[model samples]
Target: MTRITMREAISQAMWEEMERDPDVFILGEEVGVWGGSYAVTKGFYDHFGEKRVRDTPISESTIVGAAIGSALTGLRPIAEIMTINFAFSAMDHIVNQAAKLHYMFGGQLILPLVIRTVGGGGRQLGATHSQTPDAIFAHFPGLKVVAPGTPEDAKGLLKSAIRSNDPIFFIEHATLYQTRAEVPDGDYITPIGKSKVHREGRDVTIVTYSKMLETSSKAAEQLSGMGIEAEIIDLRTLRPLDMEPVLESFRKTNRAVIVEEGWRSYGVGAEVTARIYEEAFDYVDAPIQRVAQKEVPLPYNRTLEQLALPQVEDVVQAVKEVL
Candidate 1:
């Protein structure tokens, strides 16, 4: 295993997959010439050439639509939407077409399509550009939604999504590109719908994913100083959410604090909390607490934006509340 940044891990996954399968190609705004908005596809243009790393106009609908068309013709296409906020423009193609094509067509039309986009509110991208609407996309049945927290999961999960025969909405956190972690050596692939335990503890269960995983891990360290051991469950895949790990951890800890970068109401935390209560209510020692962003449009001001988003202190406080 080698340590690498989340950006490098993601880029490496796409690079390796494209090298292995000629059918796997990428299309998006600025993906070819600009090397992608977040630089995740840096140097892909020169490496893969125009045909494979084709860049399109600044139109989310066109980009996603073209990807669906190519996927129908037996080409596995990775469609980048630049940012999650812009995904609303292509909702029809994403939710209606790409997601339901295989199922609606009686499994004859296999869409090995991956819709790659970035989310989270950091760096003051404003309310419009900065949003974590992961739960909204995950609500749909046919689409597989995945958001990885660590570099290892990012590389492995992306490889799996590219190879899967279903449509996947891969959400990357905008602020986690530079975060580094140990990733396996070549040809590694993590299953799409499995949640993993990042840290083992008996005091409390802290569940999170994407950028919030980093925040919760920091909070766990601080909680440890206070003589509290927190077990963190990273929900890498949202749609086919593997709740077994979460439920098992909760049973052992008897308490939980669900943390997310999105709003608390009707968010990931809400869903997870509901499932825990439904399945593991007997193990509940305290009312589950949720640490999430303030219900408001993220501000352009850096200070206000940070305040609106969930913080490490927030997670710590939420964990304490549960205890």
Candidate 2:
């Protein structure tokens, strides 16, 4: 086992996949010569050469569009948009074309495209650059949404996403890139729709993904001292959601508090609450609670921005409420 940062694990996954499969290639702005905006692909340009690790113009729509076209023509392309906020410009290609191509053609074409981008707000990028838009892609039918919280999952899920036969929207938290964790040295693929129980407990169950998972885990630790045992479930994949584990956890704990960095209204937490109510309402001991970011444009001020997002205190308060 090797300890590596989430960014390094992701880079290793991409590099290994490109080496193992000739069909796998990557394209994005600053990806070739610049080595990506966050330096995730720092040495990829020299290792893979310009053809496979091609760079694109400052156009997110064109980048995604070209990847979709390449996938349709039998090439596995990992298209990286600079940020999730910029993906709005390419929603037509992602939602309309890449998502519906196989279904509209009656399963005639297999779109094995992986669209990877950074999301969430911790670096004070303001409203334009920091938005967790995974819910937007989860709302679509044919797209697979994934947000890995650990270095191992980051590496494992990227490998799976690249090999999947469907279009995948892989969202990475901008703040989690440098976070380090141990990753195994082997060929491992975490199934897309599976949820992992990060920390098991009996008093309450806290469901979250991406950066929120870390926050919730910290809250859970603090809660543990107060005699509140909280189970933290990391929903690795948003779409094709594996609700069985969630329902089962709710059944065991009889309480739930969902944590998300996105806005509260109609966010991923809302979906999880609805699903829990629909399937395990009778089993729940209390109303499902959600700890989400306040509903407003992410402020540019550092203090306000930190307050606007969900924090360990917010999660601890919500868990206390449910308990």
Number of the predicted model whose lDDT against the real structure is largest: 1
Which tens-of-lDDT digit does each residue in 142-235 have in candidate 1?
Answer: 9999999999999999999999988999999988999988899978899999999999999999999999999999999999999999999999
- The per-residue C-alpha lDDT of model 1 at residue 228 equals 99
Q: Could you tally the backbone clashes for each prediction?
A: 0, 0
For model 2, give the RMSD to the true fold. 0.7
Alpha-carbon TM-score of each model against the true structure:
0.99, 0.99
> lDDT of all predictions, in order shown?
0.94, 0.93
- Give the per-residue lDDT digits (tens) of candidate 2, residues 188-304: 878899998999999999999999988998998899999988999999999989888888899999999999999999999999999999998899898889999998889889999
